[model samples]
Target: MTDREKIQQILQGISKTALPAQPSESLFDAGVLDSFSLVDLVAGIEQAFGIKIPDSDLNPRQFDSIEYIEKYLSSHR
Candidate 1:
């Protein structure tokens, strides 16, 4: 699967709901994710992508949406 697909799958698992239609949509604003879910997302991303995410890079802005998460993963990888 593509990176975006993996992200969406991760998000779906965390949110336990359908993802927003827009890839750029803010998960926080859409009520799909919160501070607690962000932690789960980071763990999922790290495990799925096999990359370690440092605590210094754990900003919400870096993971606010699928597009952003893909970009972050690309850069980190």
Candidate 2:
């Protein structure tokens, strides 16, 4: 799956809901994710992408949306 697709699936798995049709939608504002869910997202992304997300570098802005998360992963990878 593409990064966006993987992200959507991860978000859906974390939130137990459908993802927005638009990849730009804010998962946080849309209530699909929250602080607690962000934690799950981090773990999911790390495992799925095989990249380390240092706990000390946790930043909500890096994961505000699918676009942001994808970009962050690209840079990190």
Candidate 3:
């Protein structure tokens, strides 16, 4: 599957929230996600995308927005 689809799945699995059709949506800013949710999100992304999300890349910026996460996964893929 494509990165966007994988990301939507990851977000759905982690937050149990309906994912927006657009990829540029701000998951955190929109209150759809929060700091406590990052732990599950990180794990989901790592497993779903088949990419290792190192501790260094686990900062808020990386998870601040869906676009950011998608970009990171795209680079890794």
Candidate 4:
């Protein structure tokens, strides 16, 4: 599957709900993510993409949405 598809699957696993229609939609605002789940999201992304996310870069704004997550992965990887 594609990167976005992997992201969506990870999100679904964390949220246990349907993904938001808009890729740019805020996962936090949509109730798809919360403070606790953010850690799981980070772990999922790292495992799926095979990239280690530094603890210093654990800001929520950097991972607020699918678009943002994709951008982060592209830039970091």
Give the candidate number with the greatest lDDT.
4
Compared with the true structure, what per-residue lDDT tens digits does model 3 show for residues 43-71?
88878767788788777877767788878
List model 2 lDDT by residue over 1-77, tens digit each.
Answer: 99988888888888966676677888888888888899999999988988889877688988988998988888887
State each model's C-alpha RMSD to the native: 0.8, 1.2, 1.7, 0.8
What are the runs in model 4 whose C-alpha is more than 4 Å off? Answer: none
Off by over 4 Å in 2: none
After TM-score superposition, what is the CA distance of residue 54 in candidate 4 from its true location, in Å?
0.6
- Candidate with better TM-score, 1 vs 2: 1
Candidate 1, 19-55: lDDT as tens digits: 8899999988888899999999999999999999999
lDDT of 1: 0.91
Choose 1 or 2, whichever is better by lDDT. 1
By how many angstroms RMSD does model 3 differ from the true structure?
1.7
Clashes in candidate 4: how many? 0
Tens-digit lDDT string for candidate 4 (1-77): 98899999999988976678999999998889999999999999999999999999989998999999999998997
lDDT of each: 0.91, 0.86, 0.76, 0.92
- Could you tell me how far off, in angstroms, the CA of residue 74 lies in candidate 4 after the best superposition? 0.3
State how far residue 10 of model 4 sits from its true place (Å).
0.3
